[model samples]
Target: MIKVGIVGGTGYTGVELLRLLARHSGVKLQAVTSRKEAGMKVAEMYPSLRGWVDLAFSTPEDARLTECDVVFFATPNGIAMQQTGELLDAGVKVIDLAADYRIKDLSEWSKWYGMQHASPDLVEEAVYGLPEINRAAIRDARLIANPGCYPTAVQLGFLPLIEAGVIDAGSLIADCKSGVSGAGRKAEVGALFAEAGDNFKAYGVAGHRHLPEIRQGLTRIAGVDVGLTFVPHLTPLIRGIHATLYAKITQDVDLQALFEQRYLGEQFVDVLPAGSHPETRSVRGANVCRIAVHRPQGGDTVVILSVIDNLVKGAAGQAVQNMNILFDLPEGTGLDIVPLLP
Candidate 1:
């Protein structure tokens, strides 16, 4: 079994990792760390993993994460960078579910994240963990930088068009909405039910942190720098992301077949039939992105709708998928979860 350790065990993504790793056939949970919650049973903090996860929370210093085969950092941005280098040097693979290593430009990362990178030397060596685009590198990488929830949905929706060279890349718009849980498990006035419930508002209209990551991924796909107008909104729901993307079509091709053929062999990305509108709930609780393509009256514009469970495909589930690739196991080993329905 592949021994695993997780840092930051009290957040939503942290517990989500525990919930999935608990049932992985090829995995064994070695350590789960939380400075504040040390010595607490994992099941005590999250009742959902009562029977599956039997480990308790320990401090990072006591976890001995270097002894594990791979360690996943579910902590905030700077936390992983502080410890990832030592772990990698100790022969333990590292996966970070944060913005620590996503952007290639160090100055850009510092400007957006507002701090000096703890491991700038390792940033160039860390592989971006979007399996669809960087699968081969992940298998040989000692460090994985998991993509953010919004970036995952946005990049998948725009990838087929950009790669086919059928859209005007300069005029791209991504209007996305995510659940309140995307803010993390912390207490905040914005995430409170009284404020977010029955309300919809865009917070990062000027520039959100995920913008650079999205642009970096898309630019890599298009083989040139791409311009994008990204706006992120917060929804009252608990666990999903809906990305409605728009681009002016510059060439004529079978849009449906393009998307279908692009993701033909991929198991997690589902391209619905032409004219279909994919709902966020259809992908809830599952490690899948359901997408649909449309052209209003065959106009000069193309609209793509994509959705995924933010906690699953966006965060922990994708991390597990990366782990599977890192170990050369089947991509869906412990991720065969069905979407939860009403």
Candidate 2:
């Protein structure tokens, strides 16, 4: 069994990892660290995990993470980079659910995240953990930088077209909306119920951090630098991301067939039948990205809709997927959750 350690187990992503990994038959929960909540029983803080998680939150120093087979850093940006190199040297695989190593350009990452990277030497070593695109790399990687929630949905929606080179990459527009929970489990005025609820507005229009990451991925996919206008919005719900991607169709091949064939064997990416609309709720709580492709009025602009539970496919669930790949287990071993619907 794979011994697993999770750092920062108090946030939405951290607990989400706990909720999934706690029951993974192939994974043994080793340690979970939360500096502020150290010594608190995991179940006591998140009653939902009462029967599944018997471990208590420990300080990072007490977690003894290097003893585990794999350690997941669900901490804020700079925390993982500070300790990842040591853990890697100890032969423990590390996966960070933050922006620490996702952007290859250290300067770009620092500019957007507002902090200098702690381990620039390891930046190139950390694989970008988007399983659909980097599955083979993930299998051999000792370190991984999990993709952000918004980037996950947007990239998946635009990938097929980008790969096929059937879309005008320079004019790509990702108009996306995510649940309030995407902000993370925190006490911020923006995330407060009274502020975020009954409110529908966009933020980071000038420049969102996820923009560079998504652009970098698409550029890699297209084999050329691509221009993208990525605008992220906050919705009133709690756990999903809906990305409506727009790209100019440069070719006439069947749009539906393109998307379907591209994701034909991909278990987590479900291409809905033609003319179907994928709702965020349809993928809530599940590590699945449901997509629907359309060419409005048979026009040049192709609109692709993609949805995923931000905490699932976007963060924790995807982390577990990477873990399964690293351990040579079935990709869906611990992620076979049916999406929660109302």
Candidate 3:
């Protein structure tokens, strides 16, 4: 069994990782660290894992993460870079579910995240952990930088169009709406239920941190700097992201066929029927990105609707998917979970 340790096991993504890893047939739960919650029983904090996850929270220094086969950092943005190098040196594969190593430009990362990268040299070596796009690199990588929630949905939505060169890359737009959980399991005035309950508002319109990461991925695919107007909104829900993408069509081609063929064998990306509209709830609690391509009135623009559970496919679930790839297991081995419905 693959021994696994998790850093920062108190957040939503952290517990979600514990839930999934506890049931993985090929894994053995090793240690989970949470400085503030050290010595607390995992199941006591998250009753959802009562019967399965029997480990307790250990402080980072006491977790001995280097002894595990793999360690997942579900901590805040700056925490992973501080410890990933040591773990890598000890032969433990590292997957950081944060922005620590996603962007290659050290200066750009510092400017956006507001901190000096603790390990900039490892940035170039860390593979972007998007299975659909970076599967081969992930297989051989010792450090994996998991893509952010917004970037995952947006990139997957725009990938086929950019790759086929059927859309004007310079005018790409991603208007995304995410549930409050996307804010993380934290206490903030913005995330309070009474504040976000019935409200619908957009934040980060001028700029969002995910912008550079998304642009980096798209530019690599298009072989040029892609122009993207990314605007993110907060919806009055708890756990999903719906990305409505737009691009002016540059050529006439069967978009449905293109998307279908592009993701033909992809296990987690679902291409809905031609005129179907995918709902965020359809992918809730599952590591699947359901997409529908549309050309209203056969106009000059194409609209792609994509949805995923922000905490699942967008975070914890995708991290597990990356771990599966790093170990050469079936991509969906522990991620074949069905989406939760109302």
Candidate 4:
């Protein structure tokens, strides 16, 4: 069995990791760290795991992370970089569910995240953990930099077009909306029910942190620097990400066929039949990205709708998927969870 440890087990992504790992047949939960919640039973803090997780949260200092086969950092950005080197040296594979090592350019990452990268040397070494794009690299990587929530949705929507050279990569727009839970389990005025609920508004138009990460991934796929205007909105719901992507068509091809063929063998990416609009709820609670392609009135602009559960495909679930790849397990092992629908 693969021994696993999770750092930062108090946030939404952290608990989501626990929920998924608890039932993984091939995994043995070794340790979960939470400085503040140390000594608290995992089930006591999150009743959802009452019967599955009997381990108590331990402080990072007390956790036996080096002994685990793989350690997932579900903590904030800086935390992982601070300790990843030691973990990797100890033969422990590390997967960071944060932006600590996603962007290859350390200066650019610093500019956007507003913090000096603690381990800039590891930036180039950490493979970006998007299985659809970097599956081969992830298999041999000891350090993984998981893609951000918005980037995951937006990139999956635009990848096929970019790869086929059918869309103008110079001017791409990602108008994405995410649920309140994407903000993490925090006590912030902006994330409070009274402020986020019954409201729909876009923030970070000036430039969200995910913008660079998206551009970086798209640029790699397009083989050129891609221009992207990414705007993120906060919806009142608790889970899901809806990304409406727009790109100018440079060629005329059957978009439905293109998407279908592009993701023909991808287990997590679902390409809907033509004229279908994917809903975020359809992918809720599951590690899946449901997409639909359209060219309204046969215009030059092509629109793609992509949806996924932010905490699942966008975070913890994707982390687990990467773990499966790293361990040479079935790609869908422990991730065959059906989407939770209303």
Off by over 4 Å in 4: none
Off by over 4 Å in 1: none
Ranking by lDDT: 1, 3, 4, 2
lDDT (tens digit, per residue) of candidate 4 on 1-342: 999999999899999999999999899999999999899999999999999999999998889899999999999878999999999999999999999999998889889888998888898999999999999999999999999999999999999999999999999999999999999888899889999999999999998999999999999999999989888999999999999999999999999999999999999999999999988889989999999999999999999999999999999999999999999999888789998779
Cα lDDT, model 2, residue 320:
95
lDDT string for model 3 (1-342, tens) is 999999999999998898788889999988999989899999999999988988999998999898999999999999999999899999999999989999999999998999998898899999999999999999999999999999999999999999999999999999999999999899999999999999999999989999999999999999999999999999999999999999999999999999999999999999999999999989988999999999999999999999999888999999999999999999898898988888
Q: Model 3 lDDT vs. the true structure?
A: 0.95
Model 2, 20-119: lDDT tens per residue? 9988899899999988889999999999999999999999899999899999999888999999999999999999999899999988998999998889
lDDT of each: 0.95, 0.92, 0.95, 0.94
TM-score of 4: 0.99
What is the TM-score of each predicted model, taking all chains together?
Answer: 0.99, 0.99, 0.99, 0.99
Model 2, 141: alpha-carbon shift in Å? Answer: 0.5
List model 1 lDDT by residue over 259-311, tens digit each: 99999989899999998999889998889999999999999999999999999
Task: Give the range where candidate 3 is weakest over 10 consecutive residues by summed lDDT.
Answer: 333-342
* Clash count of each predicted structure: 0, 0, 0, 0
